[model samples]
Target chain A: MNAFIIADNIISPLGFTSSENFDELKKMHTGVKRLEKSTLSNEPVCAAVIDTNKLDAAFQKLSAKQEYTRLEKMVILSINDCLNQNKNIDISNKKTLFIFSSTKGNVDLLDASLASKFDKKRIYLWETANVIAKHFNNPNQALTVSNACISGVLAIILAKRLLEENKYDTIIVSGADILTHFVVSGFQSFKAISNEVAKPYDVKRDGISLGEGCGTVVVSNNKSLAVTLSASSRAESRDEGQASAIIISGGASSNDANHISGPSRTGDGLLLAIEKTLKESNVKASEVNYISGHGTATLYNDDMESLAITDAQLASVPMNSLKSYFGHTLGAAGVIESIIGIHSMRENTLIGTYNFNELGVTKPINIIKNTQKQEVNNCLKTAAGFGGCNAAVFFQKHR
Target chain B: MVNGTEVYSDSSLPSADFIKSAYKHFQLNYPKFYKMDHLCKLAMVASDLLLKHNPITKKYASEDIAIIIANSASSLEIDTEHQNTISDKNNYFPSPAVFVYTLANILIGEIAIRNSIKGENTFFIFDKFDADFMGSYNNSLLSSNKATCCISGWVEFYENEYEAFLYLVEKEKNELNIEHTSEQLNKLYINQI
Candidate 1:
């Protein structure tokens, strides 16, 4: 049984909706900019912050309660958009599973509660799931994943498994994270924040620019024009195959085992993930049309990722990172990038790697320097996170 | 298959003779790093028990083994303590050492490093156990061939409550045992007798 992404909604620094974001991408526009004067200095002023009040008002029309935090509001709004677009789908009685992908589920609320001694019950992670489920009025089970940067993609894979097993008729996968002082200071302490707008795959690229956004895809057995094909042929096939028609044919997650905060210099873990994904998809490295990398513009990350792709013999695949346009959205990066890749494939165009003039790392891979028109059939999206966790997903246009 | 082991700081830890004797035995026999967290200690103990009389370590490369852990609380007891140092108005600075443990999956990394096993790794969070999800997730990992052997289980720790169980699962050559579905495991562990 194959699973497909029927509809999607995204709220990012680039734009608030899919059409708006796609339009900006078509024009090669970037939303990342210098922080306002009132923001902190060490914090690295570049970020993708959504207007919370506007998001809240939009959600209030769909929800009965209005007390959710910015993170919750983003998720609610994104889900609402997905449901609205995929109208009249009878999820009311189906076992509609909810998979929330977030590194910080209202962690800002937890941070605030620490200072104000607010009610502890309101800040619990489970409560956030409950709120989302209540708003949807679905009977299916709900789960929240907090797997650092890989949470978003992991959630989608989990939903795919659940749907394949006939456990739920509809699976709503949503990822949301907000720029908070807690996250800001943590990245800043590691010197992982860029001073200017992020420049992925560039020789002068410094570090990541933290951004916040929420994105969701409603996946079901229901097929539509928006459906992106899976690389894996069977739900149970384990053999890593060569790259094929941009299907999410097969994928895997692994840890570098070298460092908690840094990727392995050898790209050992990343190679394993890519190999597994290709094997499952039954495709070869030469067949991969493009690679959407987890290029945070950080010195270590880009270097390691470049090495991994090259080692996997995917030297010719056009590679780029969307972080230059929207900054690193942390937990939301995986799904957001996947959505963007799907859009690019659908439009038969390749998005450029923003702010790239000189090649930073010595690798044979072709770095996308400017927006180019191309026929893309298969694309691979990969992300690595703090706990040495790495994930890779393959996408192909549905035939 | 997922495998795991655990240690808990029960009220009688220091005075409990049997537990103390167990600790001494581990100190003399196992690697020094195994003495860190209860989860790691338990993993070492359980792995030793599971690997006993088996050729898994020698037969497979380190990268063939993987660890997937699901937990609640998310190292919160440690997180709260870490936050307290930073929360104080006068000394509002977070500790880098403590902040590292904020993620639940680090336990998997620690275990993999100690065992020299490198494969697929993931940390999942749920309020309570769901047998269906566990079974499906493990099957997914195995079916994908991400790991020839998977060490999967639950490790929950709060201020006073700690519970952990790890199971080593590999694909069975023959037909699966019908009785060992995730529903059965969930009922056995999550639903108390």
Candidate 2:
């Protein structure tokens, strides 16, 4: 029951595809920048925003019309990129399921002026999925998943189940969120926004920098489930033919059951999720080599993650957070970060945890400070968000 | 089979009052209930009733139970409320309390904390009630040894209209008439039983 990720793309400020983003990461490039007198705040605020001019240019190349919203453009572009190279799969087939993951779809529509022109239905998440499906000429009904920060990972978990049931041969998952005044002011109100670039698990870390991006991944069952046996042993399966194939070993979601705005002091919820995922996947904490953490750089999140790692006995594993590079893309963080981790595993590389100067949490933990070349076989991705929700997923490199 | 309930508008009472009456019916004393948005309140009440009398869950570990919830209008009503707050540039006030429930999964958090159940849970937003998805998902979770029992169903709420149907799914049940299937779900859902 191997769910293989065949194709993927990440559209962000640094690049338009997963490979391009990975290249930027190898160079220690960051997209966060301070903006003065923007729509979100009166003073200067730092954020990672996709270049709108470049986005419009890309969207125009996709469609001649100038009607797509910023969010719409990003979604369509990311999904289209993956599907264009994916010739074996027919998105128009009813058996293929399309799932959209986003914390907020067209939330910019909430503005008074945008609200006037756009009907309330325009902001409905389901409608946004419909538009993306229609653009691709896919007849399958689209499903939207809105589970706060863990939406992206949950989508992967759900798609894996759907694949195991043989209901759909292929699942298309796209996750994205835009940085707007509505979101910025909300984070600002909670004092979760740092005036400068955030350093996750760093002594001087203050808050998270809001970011916007979209990511799409194509998932399907391993085509090589059937194979010939020689001496009661099989060399390889058809799906495992690709050297870079990545398989999802296990996924589990849990709730902090604590404060909605803050993470738990004990990190009990994330610990449960990690333990369950490992048990389900038959992987042990001692076997895990890399950790893709949900280090939002906020005081509570980093501290909580340290406690969870120690609780799960994974504190010493090489850990890195893409937040320092992408600045926390909300719903897209899990998918985008997971995609990078998958590629890193294939490339046999470990990325550096950016902006970290010293140990920030009370608990001792392992934070990768520089890029290292190593063979990574098994990696875990974990995220905890508002509403006391947490998700953990495991992945292994296909031989 | 363990529990089924629905809260909607009454000519004599508003939606909020109906939820209040349901809360009082169960004698729920949680102070946070009053602060939650409509969607969360409806879900919290439904789950409270489903698990209140089922003491069988005590036989398993705290993380043995899984929850799967979905709805069409995910925090749409609250989104509108939060929208109104920031709509006015002169009086822009975005409260973190309201912003927290913008996602539908927050209700899952409320129920998990109230009962001390730490298990796998997810929230889906579909255009319509897809019983097929719900049934198959929980089936996999249960069969794959992910959870010994599950609290799974659809919880949808808007400004004036609301409906909730949550069923307890487990391998061994203590005398319950309901079966975990799409057909049974439609039956209970249509009749609002």
Candidate 3:
């Protein structure tokens, strides 16, 4: 509950910077478009994909060798932006650890027949992480978090625990997952992909649109360091001499104990996590100012989230699902969305859902239909994933 | 360290039959056991052995028990199996059953459901066993009141190569027979205990 998110960035299709991505959201601009049939499949599918040319240009600035994969490039670019803003911190220091969270990192490296002579070691997520860490000159071996979609938020919780133990001074938490044939086909097989742009919590909502993105948040225990970061980025990120940050107050994750791919119809797992978060933060449910819902727009996921929100007594809070703008970035969803939520709280403006028009769930809950300006103090970010894993993280704005 | 009971397979027997024998030895009736992939079966069997050593159903509430599994291979074997299913153009069928167990942490879900553990769970992919993480994380969870008892250890399976050393961690030193220290943890992991 003490760690401060000193810096953050979301590099995606909408834009490379958090503000750029947020500006698109303010205009209700979507990154989702029809996937190229020759590249994805014959079936029509809409997704939020990155422009390959822009990535190549950014990668050229970062390194001369074109060794990093598209996913790794995005992750490095995102973290570099955060690290650039915090020039005072020694990024390669031993106390500075990095956690890479992703659903399927480099799963595309595997040959289709399992007989391709591709280096079998490249298939390891840790391998990709080591390459990224070495580029940053980080002394410690990067920790790989590959636990379904909740990996991003879980990394934040892991950082908090380790920081509490005084094991590290800084934790660079990065989450990224690029769309690949393996993932696209897997979701396609599950019949969970949306043919059109996703409509979260809307009656016309069909399914999730797969997305590609990378998000990084710099969490440090020292308060003075944050004051310096805010001072450095006054024009771009904050107001004049306003030294403030969002502290991670509470975090916990639970299993549905019901199914692997499907969420619990009763929303028991999410309710348990939210209850734990509130108990840890020592805040009443009504104290939460905003809710960052992980509405993948899938039928059962959205419905279950609504029930959980109501159970947590947070149904009255304004909420938005960024997935409608950026699509579901798998491992990147939790951190990317949380970073935007932190910025939104600082600006006192919550962006509306990109494509949501109607409420379809049986549980009646408040969904932010239009961008609203209000005083914000604390917010809750929740993500559920393939393993029936549900994570709820609470962050509070520090005065 | 396993308190009073422990189970280990030398990889001489088949994985499926070994798991079946475990269900029979424990006289458990969870029908879902057979449906799990190799990685899940490995974790569930290990947890069954540990729970048989130190019973939790009567002492602690279900929500107080958390599980954390760390592995090196991380569902590689099952991933290959699933990859095989969709590799060929003629047989392009990614069955949800096999696809469900693709993530290593799903084993946590399998163990939690069987034991009715409704607490926090996470999976970490480490190149090798990390004693420091295993000890400190378990202690931190207990200190923060996130979990009363944590079932934490290493689980890895790919092809016929596999190793699992699940340890039961608690706040009370007297609760379990073994000392929950990094040294003791490494000993248990390396078969020194």
Give the winner by TM-score.
3
lDDT of 1: 0.70
**Each candidate's iRMS in angstroms?**
1.9, 1.3, 1.3
Task: Indicate the DockQ of the complex predicted as candidate 3.
Answer: 0.66
Candidate 1, residue B48: the lDDT equals 51
- What's the distance in Å from true for residue A152, model 1? 1.5
For residues A1-399, what per-residue lDDT tens digits would candidate 2 score against the true structure? 678887788999999988789888877888888898787675689999998999988888885443666898998999878876556667888888899999988988878767776567778888888888888878987878888999988888777877888878889899899988878877887889888988998999999998999988888885442111111112321223324557888889988777777899999899988998898788889999899999999998999999999999998999988898898898888889888888677667788877877988868899988777877887899988887889999988655
Give the per-residue Cα lDDT of candidate 3 at A348: 70
Best of the candidates, lDDT: 3
Off by over 4 Å in 3: A36-38, A64-66, A112-119, A232-234, A237-243, B1-12, B15-17, B24-26
Q: Which runs in model 1 stand beyond 4 Å of their true positions?
A: A36-44, A113-119, A224-247, B1-10, B14-25, B28-55, B59-61, B143-146, B173-179, B187-193
Model 2 DockQ vs. reference: 0.69
Candidate 3: residue A187 lDDT (0-100): 83
Could you tell which candidate, 2 or 3, scores higher by lDDT? 3
The weakest ten consecutive residues by lDDT in model 1 chain B span: B1-10
Give per-residue CA lDDT, model 3, range B8-78, as digits (tens): 43345676676667667777767788888878877777788788768876678877888888887777787
